[model samples]
Target: MTAIRTLLVANRGEIARRVFRTASAMGIRTVAVHSDPDAHAPHVLDADRAVSLGGSTPAESYLDAAKILDAARRAGADAVHPGYGFLAENAGFAAACAAAGLVFVGPSPESIAAMGRKDRAKEIARKAGVPVLPDAPVTGDDPDGWAVAGADVGFPLLVKATAGGGGKGMRLVTGPDGLAEAITGARREAAGAFGDAAVFLERHLGFARHVEVQVFGDVHGGAVHLGERECSVQRRHQKVLEESPSPAVTPELRERMGATAVALVRELGYVGAGTVEFLLDEDGDFFFLEMNTRLQVEHPVTEEVYGLDLVRMQLRVAAGEPLGLDRAPEPRGHAIEVRLYAEDPANGYLPAPGPLHHYAHPTHPGVRFEDGVAAPGEVSPFYDPMLAKVVAHAPTRAEAAAMLAGALDATEVHGPVTNRAMLAALLRDPDFLAGETRTDFLDRHPVLLAPPPPTPEVVHLGAAVAVTAARRRAADPVTSLAPPGFRLLPGSAPATARWTPIGGEPADVGYRLGAAFGDTALTVTVGGTTTELGLRDLGPDGVRVVHDGVAVPCIVRVHPDGSVWVNDPAAQSGWRPEPRLPDPELSAAAAGPVAEVPGTVAAVLVAAGDQVTAGQKLVVLEAMKMEHPATAAADGVVAAVHVEPGQYVEAHTVLVTLTTGPTA
Candidate 1:
């Protein structure tokens, strides 16, 4: 048996950090490889040694197998862990590692090659007696032939890229007219993402549940399955929330699926961690989707449920350890995980990459947070925008969902509008609570997109908390004695500050020191309503506002940009105090449609001096491997196109100027 001494992680972000933690716990030295953009990333700092790939994009850095191999060699790493994405599923990379005499902390190269292509994997599964949906290989450039194949599979089918997963190269087609466009888009995306343009047609189950069984195999010809996880809650065909021990699967069905997954694992001689994905229809029938050849992003749910450390298991298996388990352990509790990304759910979940000013997670029991970066960090547009994965475990599913929802509600994630609010709302959603989730969960429920506005009480409490915090910071021996708002001259009015909640209108808060309680007590008035609250305790720990003989605890922080964050038990809100004077620089915002994120200009659909209607896509911006199109807000004529394809632009950079009367 080969014991791994120095290990290298050939990936970045949360997964890298996760593997590093496990390797370190096992007394193994860890090395991290990063691109130019991730030079100062948390994972780099977490490693004992880090190698610089010296490139800004994945193609020039992480995706380049040669650079990674060199990095491992220079770091003297005997084992390399390709933590999901990047080169994780590249069969050639696995073989190269083997040829270089380094243990790849994953499945064998043969297994990876066999399951790398969706089309080929389906064939293998069908031959192994596993249920699979019929598909047709999309070859050649004949549109008519493609149409006939798509029709043969029936309407409402999927045009999917056979190379990689993660919803990158998959499109749903409703009829014949959409098939060609879907194939073209899927091929382009697949090539850009995976370097493979091969695609195929598969029957689309619009209302199916995406479930996957977590199976582990060892070198001693032993294998076991760890039940299944449900990943049906999705947006843009990507999973948003996942839970283990799927509510839709019964004990009998789970036994059948687990057996099938283990059979396939044994059939392929697969080793280490892998997931066999399936699409379960409403009629209790399941069909094989594709198999992921590495550690899944949602493995935490399984670990939490089974009381096992999957990363540790992978490490042991890579070291040629035998499967110690005779059978899968009975899951103790239900676990739920939600992916927290740096995107805007309100804006169609657009990638909003920017500086993460304040990032924090709850430390409550039964709650676990796997994060990629800390506060005062930047969410680079060069990589995936996922910030962290929050998981919760409990005895019951409802309890687990509620626990997860409450934790998210208490989390303080500032900057870059996120889907935190939406995730929290979905966890508590009625249909979600009833376990009626399917692939079209988001489509069926649109109200979960936007967060509910803060209550009046919360707003009032926020104003009080903000004032109390400011006073505490400004307090001195002399100032403490002065009544609140007591100016040098008489007849002076109390100080009034205009503050706006994150999603609410601005309100003027009048604060004074003298209150019904004592000189230290405070009274705040907003919109002709007054509340008396005394500062019980105020310091770095937090502040307590006493109102009606009840003290409400709050965490108040002032951001570098002058925005005040107030997190209490009721809600978490940011209050931006209106500047006393408007700044000249901020007033120069362009009067045109601007890029909402930093990305390369994929295409410019319109030329200068062209007439256009409202909502016409004028420019397409590609960021984080997703395309975002800038559209016209009103009917106008294009005056000038500021950017061209292949040009990189920053957020708020004007793309195209549209004039109503004439072109400039």
Candidate 2:
């Protein structure tokens, strides 16, 4: 076996950090490649050596095979770990590494090419005696041909991009009339995401459970399976939560599925880490979906149960060592993992990228936090909105679910909007608790999507306490020149503050300072109720406000418009202080439609002087690998277009103006 002395991770974020941790433990020097925006990223700082890929976008940096190879050569790296996504499953990248005499820590280029396309992979599985769902032949650019093929595949089918995975380039067509549009949209998404627009039709199983078997193979011809992970909890066909030891999978079925995965790996002569995905129906019959010829994003749940580091196994296998496993070990316990993303669940789950001012993770037994960005860092609009993955393990499925739920409840992310509350609610959902999760879980239970907002009293009180504390600090004469041991004396006079919640009426708060609890301790009265509040300064821009023994950590930023943006675990709200002055420009622009999330304008459907109807699509913005259409508010003439195609805009930026002519 050839030993790899130095390895270069050809990706970024948590996956890169994960590979580096394993490589360092194995006494291998690790190299990191980063883009311009990720110059100070945690993964770069953790590596022994780092090289700049230069550009910010994926094509210019992570996905550029030439640049990655150059970085590897400069760092003297003997091997490259793709670490999933970007170029992880790219056959050309694997071939390039092989040609450069550098070990690619994955299956061979031939295996990747064989399994990269869903249509081809299904054919391979069918040939190997694995059951596969009936699928239409790959469609060409002709729209009529696509329509005909889709009809034969049947209605309620899925238009799937052959070249890539993830929900991108995938569309669910319930009828024949929508086939052409679905095909076009799928192709556009596929071409943008994977550089390929080839698509095919597949029989869509509306309520099937998404289960996949994790398989490992070595160059020595040894292969094994690490059981299965249930990934039925999804949104927009993308997995949100994953768990190992699926409730639907029994010992007999697990063995059968495991055997099937191993057989396919052996047939393909695959090496290194790979995942064999399958769709399990209610009758317990499973059909092969496709094989992901690389590590999965949800691999942690499998690793947690098996008590093994899959990355370490990948390294050993890439070095040409045997798996050393005659039979797969039985998973000891249960594990659950949820992806934490910077998206607003209340607003159609739109991507919400901003600075993470007060990021805190839960510290509990059997809890793991794999994060990409540290607090005080910006979640850039250029990449996926996923910030971290939180996983929990326990001796039982119920316990694991509860533990993960609690971990999410305790975790505080106070900057951009996140799906923390929604994920926690899903874990506690009755159907989820009963293991009735399916691919349409979210669609069936829309209530779990938008979590209830915090109590009005909590918001008002929290804001009052925060504002009062800030004012108190500023009012003190010694605040700017205080000594290390200096403490502010309690004041007798009550402090009064008035502020209006974003969508609520103005509130008047009266509070008096008491003994210090770091910053200020006060009893605030609002809306005929008084509650004790303890405010502690976390940093220049953050505070920990405690009420009734529960702490609410928040980051409070005051904009130039005299508005306070309070980001807290309870919720996010903007408060305007008393005597709120309106800007005429902003007030006039408010009549038009504004973007709900930060993204680049993909298309401006309406130009100045165009007549539009209410709810008509006016602009399409792309963010976080999804497109959001901003529609006109009322029937009117387009007075102006604020943003053009390819222009990046922030959340709530007005993109179009309209003249309603006597009505709006």
Candidate 3:
């Protein structure tokens, strides 16, 4: 009840670091609780004191409520702030924190448990006079339920997990025939994701915009909405881009939504920062979705627009202070935020979890970074693949979007293939620029996901450069024969040997050295659409090859096997240029380990000494809360099985090694 002197940030990634920053600024001590793998995470460095929670995985670390409370107690923290995800909305965790006499910087336990179930929240929404979509009757035992509006309404419908936020228990059912599969699938996934398979169906509002009102409540009985954020731009039900004051939300609609949000908070007696989410359909009709009983990931956009720090508000509310205002404050300028993930967008958005090689963020006024971790290596795979959240604010939405685009271009991340280019493309897209976005924005639009093709000029220039390099190779002073030519006379013009560009290829011009053109007999090879080599200056001993008027440094070396090693001359001073050679082992293609997505490991069958058939299941990796088996690459004996039961391995982590069978 007294001033929150020390708060234990029981979270990770950008959110933890974000909360720690606010706590430090408020002259409050912060305790960062981390797992073994996250000992080196940025939040640990930013906190006043740090505590080791436990193992690497979520259940072993952040999800362990008892352990987190103990860590808070050990760190001398008087309060526990569950940032957004993990156990943030867990009613049991909240109750436990209250029982431990530590401030839980969120809603009351009852509100959490009420909204914790999809069916219960729907009933509550219906009673609150909020438009609630009709669904199947709720059963005591949480089974993944199913509901549908009609096939005529849409091509796809959403089946959501009842217990928690995330794409874990969510699935898009394409047709009515797929409802059963989708239900069972959603149930299985929800079980793994939230320890409950209970799910409910909503008429899939495909073109719906996710506009949520940020409602804050203090224990002293004050609650209000801080406006809305557009979180519709997402992939696989995961939000990527969010902005405040959704383009579609009018002042009237905002008031209605805000009033509805406050009504729900009052009905449930909810406390702290919570988001009442609604689906603003294409017809401008908004439907009550659900309530998140914690601070949101995209809260910064709201903070920027509303000109109030939600985290600081949470800290103040936890310390038993009022909202400090009688009502929701007027919102300010526009703000946009993009969640930069550590994944390869081109390769089906595969998680590229590894060392961050080069990380640089552009320093500018309007742009702000709520980053948790950094470069120089080791972005742990045993966690969310989100790298950072970059935000930009401006007087106008268009300017904010422009600032975001420029920031993305200026910032360089060489560690992994990120969605940086795709995000930039989305920000500039005419549809997005017009503010017509939907939940299916990413799914329906393939153009935003694809990298922009190279311009025609660049293509032509690259081809020309390659051809020029080829001619330079043939015209070098160390060169010998020009297509093994025979010279007739010394005074006569050297017999010009003609080379063909071939079909669709650049022109290859071959000519012996003229007396004035060069000092040594030169043979110029041309390929592609342009001349390969432009004879710049040829001296008695050395000749400088010029391509595109740029002095390029090229190194030539002969290996022991007489293979040529060509290297770029302008390699960085401290680093030696690596010799490029064909990796003999990588020449042939083969199916490697099974990709580990966001799922559970249902079973791991083969042991280290087990012989397996080509189609046999070696390991099962469950994701989105479903199980998938990783079969053998070919008929072979398991030389080494790297994973065991319940061991979560990432995609391409070499789960098992195989040796050829006896048939060989």
Best model number under lDDT: 1
RMSD to true structure for each model, in Å: 3.5, 4.8, 9.0
- The regions of model 3 sitting more than 4 angstroms off are 137-155, 453-593, 596-600, 603-645, 650-664
- Every model's TM-score: 0.89, 0.87, 0.76
lDDT of 3: 0.70
Where does candidate 2 have its weakest 10-residue lDDT segment?
480-489
**Descending-lDDT candidate ranking:** 1, 2, 3
Candidates 2 and 3: which is better by TM-score? 2
Q: At residue 620, what lDDT does model 3 achieve?
A: 65
Q: How close is candidate 2 to the true structure, as a TM-score?
A: 0.87
Mind giving the per-residue lDDT tens digits that candidate 3 earns over 119-224? 7888889987899654553233322233233233344667778888856778777777777656666776676666777876666766678889989888888888
Residue lDDT tens for model 1, 1-664: 8999999999999999999999999999999999998989999999999999988877889999999999999999999999998889999999999999999999999999999899999999999999999789998999999999998898899999898788888999999998987897788778777888899999999889999999999999999999999999998888999999899999999999999999999999999999999999999999999999999999999999999999999999999998798778998889999999888787788887877789987799999999998889899998888999999999999999999999988888876667887899999999999999999999999989885743335444544454654565467665665454443344446568787765457888776654334424566788998876666555544567676767677777777777677777756666677745543432332435788789888778899878888777888787887778889877789888889998989877888887764333
Tell me the lDDT of candidate 1. 0.85
Residues 362-383, candidate 2: write the lDDT tens digits. Answer: 6898999999888668787778
